[model samples]
Target: MVPYIRAQNVNLTFRPKNRDPVTALQGLSLEVGRGEFLSLVGPSGCGKSTFLNVLLGLLRPDQGEIHLDGKKISGPGYERAMVFQEFGLLPWRTVLANVELGMELKGVPASIRRERASELINLVGLTGFEHHYPHELSGGMKQRVGLARALATDPEVLLMDEPFAALDAQTRDLMQAELLQIWDRTKKTVIFVTHSIEEAAYLSDRVVVVTSRPGRAKKLIDIKLPRPRDYEMRLTPEFNDIKATIWNSLKDELISRGIGDGR
Candidate 1:
């Protein structure tokens, strides 16, 4: 089957004022199959986030081509939406208003936008808190609102960048479970960026490991376990095995970068 998202020979670089150029991604390539859950993980400054941005069309690679559903990707399109680690919600807007913003930008009729936003709010389990402002919501709730906002556009692909990184351990685990539930319900192709081996193993159909800075694909590990995954499955031997393999594979690269043992 043709991949829903494809990136070929991708290269990205940047030059900041009074500094040598930084190579964010060097000849990185990736593909995401239809309805697949793919996770990209690497050490800090390894360009995992850059890959997500490139796929979302938020950043143009200096080299390489990206395609969505077999069409060339030139700029940001409604078929792709993103959720960031920071939530990126408008502080002044209520949950409903924030979720409705995307529809409004797309010129969707106000009434229809309201209806669609309401449905997505409920889907993300924020029905009763639609009127609450961002500040009044907890971190997990804010991220949920961000996810709802992304889903409101009916995107074919969802790009998440370490969205659970900021949450406490307990909240992060809860959000991870919630994210899997949401993905099962939505069936949207998802490309997630994370640093945790455990998170990638638990949440993805495939995990794409990358080398350190000037990143390149190091390996792809298939996660064949059944879906509707929950805490019970996380305790199984299979899960630990997968996590161990990833740790062994990535430990060397992380060490080479002087971030040995992720300390």
Candidate 2:
């Protein structure tokens, strides 16, 4: 069977006027199985988020192609949605209204969208805060609203670009566990871009480490850790081993780019 998502020899370049062109991705290829949670990690500016935008159809590749299921992706479709690191909630809208935004744009009726939004609001653990606006909520709560909004459209694939990176350490960890729970229940095919090696190890079924600049897949490591994961699991030797493996791969990329010492 064909992979649920495939990127073959994908390349993209940024050609800002009067400046030298920067290649974001070069010959980056990978295949994701249906309902798989895949994370991309590498040195900063390695095009992980750029690749996510490509998958979202926000940017067209200069070469190669990406296919969803058996269809080639030419532009953004309702089948995919993204959650950003900065909570992309509208300050003017309440939690419920924001969650309803996607479905609303898709022409879903108020009654139906309201019901679905309510359910998702609850799913993201923001049930009673429906009336609250973005300003009234904490960083984590705003992210929950963003997550709920992303799911409001019922997309088959979810693209997350460091959705919890802004939160405090404790909140980030809590959100990670919450996100896994949501993923378990929804089973959405997720392509997450995160710089945290531990976060990638904890959340992904497979972690893809890319090379720096003109990013390409450097290593694809499978995490064999059991699911229904908890903080206690982080203390296990297996978890640390996985983190170490990913770090070593990413470390090599950084060292190659003169970003850090191997030590």
Give Cα-based local distance difference scores for all models: 0.91, 0.94
Tens digits of per-residue lDDT for model 1, 1-263: 77777899899998889999999999998888999999988898999998888888889999999989899888889999999989999999999999998898999999999999999999888889989999999999999999999999999999999999988999899989999998988899999999889999999999988999999899999998888898889899999999988888888889989989663
**Candidate 2 lDDT over residue span 35-102, tens digit each:** 99999998889899999999999999999999999899999899999998898899999999999999
* TM-score of decoy 2: 0.98
- Tell me the number of clashing residue pairs for each predicted model: 0, 0
Model 1 lDDT on a 0 to 1 scale: 0.91
Candidate 1 minimal-lDDT segment of 10 residues: 254-263
Off by over 4 Å in 1: none
